[model samples]
Target: MSSDALWYFARGSGVVSLILLTVVVALGIGARSGRPAFGLPRFAVNLVHRNAALLSVVFLGAHVTTLLFDEYANLRAVDLVVPFIGNYSPFWQGLGTVALDLLLAIVVTSLLRHRIGVRAWRTVHWAGYLSWPIALAHGLGAGSDADTWWLWTISLACLAVVVAAVVWRTSAAFEARTDRAVRRVEPRLRAGIR
Candidate 1:
């Protein structure tokens, strides 16, 4: 395939990846809301997010796979993980490498959550926020399709959702902290803890 085609292809796949990441973020917030989130809404949100994440990863795999097929892009599968090696575009190629690394970390952390424990899983999963931006940058910088109006529109939508999710997570964390402070002061709460 032509270099232009490969660039457009990666851009499209990158958008799907971003959308999946957003779903995962939404699920993560629900999971943090304590036991109160055991209801259907929380369950659905978590389910969709998890499924989306998996799908995103799948599309990412396809995106990388296609890069190899597109001879003009001159990318190998390893370059998907290695960065700076995709002969299609070297200077900006490393961004994909960084994003892929972050994604790998998240997947490993998630798979090991049961064995490593929830706290460890949480610490690693927090990397998702940073991964979002890195992925976006990779798409925009290395993408052959970056200049398309449709691509720009989709990119903006992804950015909006990411920002909203971050805001919600921050708000939830603050509320949780506030609640903990109040609970810490109440004699009943202290007794329950003990």
Candidate 2:
């Protein structure tokens, strides 16, 4: 297609990827929250998370490919792997590169989770949290239409959803930890072990 069409396709893919990434993050947090929904089971939540993550990856591939093909962006293939190595809006594009690298690591470790061990997999998975924000920043800073109201609305909504999920996760973790501490202290007090 023409350069203009290719550019539009790239921008569209990037926006869709961001939306999918938000879904993946929300599903992951929801699953971890451990609250049973009306009909959706934990397994289903996990399955959706995994599938959405894969879908996001696919869109990301499209975004990268279209950008590379669009002469206007001037993004070299190597820029996809190596951060800050691209001539295209170097710093912002580099953030995208870093986000992509983190995502790849998350995906590979997830696929190999059984063999690599749960602890290792979890450690890598935390990088997903980092990747999401880096990607948002890249999109906001690098895109030509960042000033558009629609993009800003979507970005803010995504941010709100993720932030809410994080707050839920953190409170749940803290509560659980406090419960365990209380349990430990109660047993010691009863046993006179002070």
Once fitted onto the true fold, the runs of candidate 2 whose alpha carbons sit more than 4 angstroms away are 34-39, 170-194
- lDDT, each prediction: 0.73, 0.89
**Which candidate has the top score in lDDT?**
2
Off by over 4 Å in 1: 1-11, 29-31, 35-40, 171-194
> Which digits, one per residue and each the tens of the lDDT, describe model 2 over residues 48-150?
8889999999999999999998999999989999999789789999999999999999989989999999999999998998899999999998997799999
TM-score, each model?
A: 0.75, 0.84
Query: Quick one: RMSD of model 1?
Result: 4.3
lDDT score, candidate 1: 0.73
Q: What is the TM-score (0 to 1) of candidate 1? A: 0.75
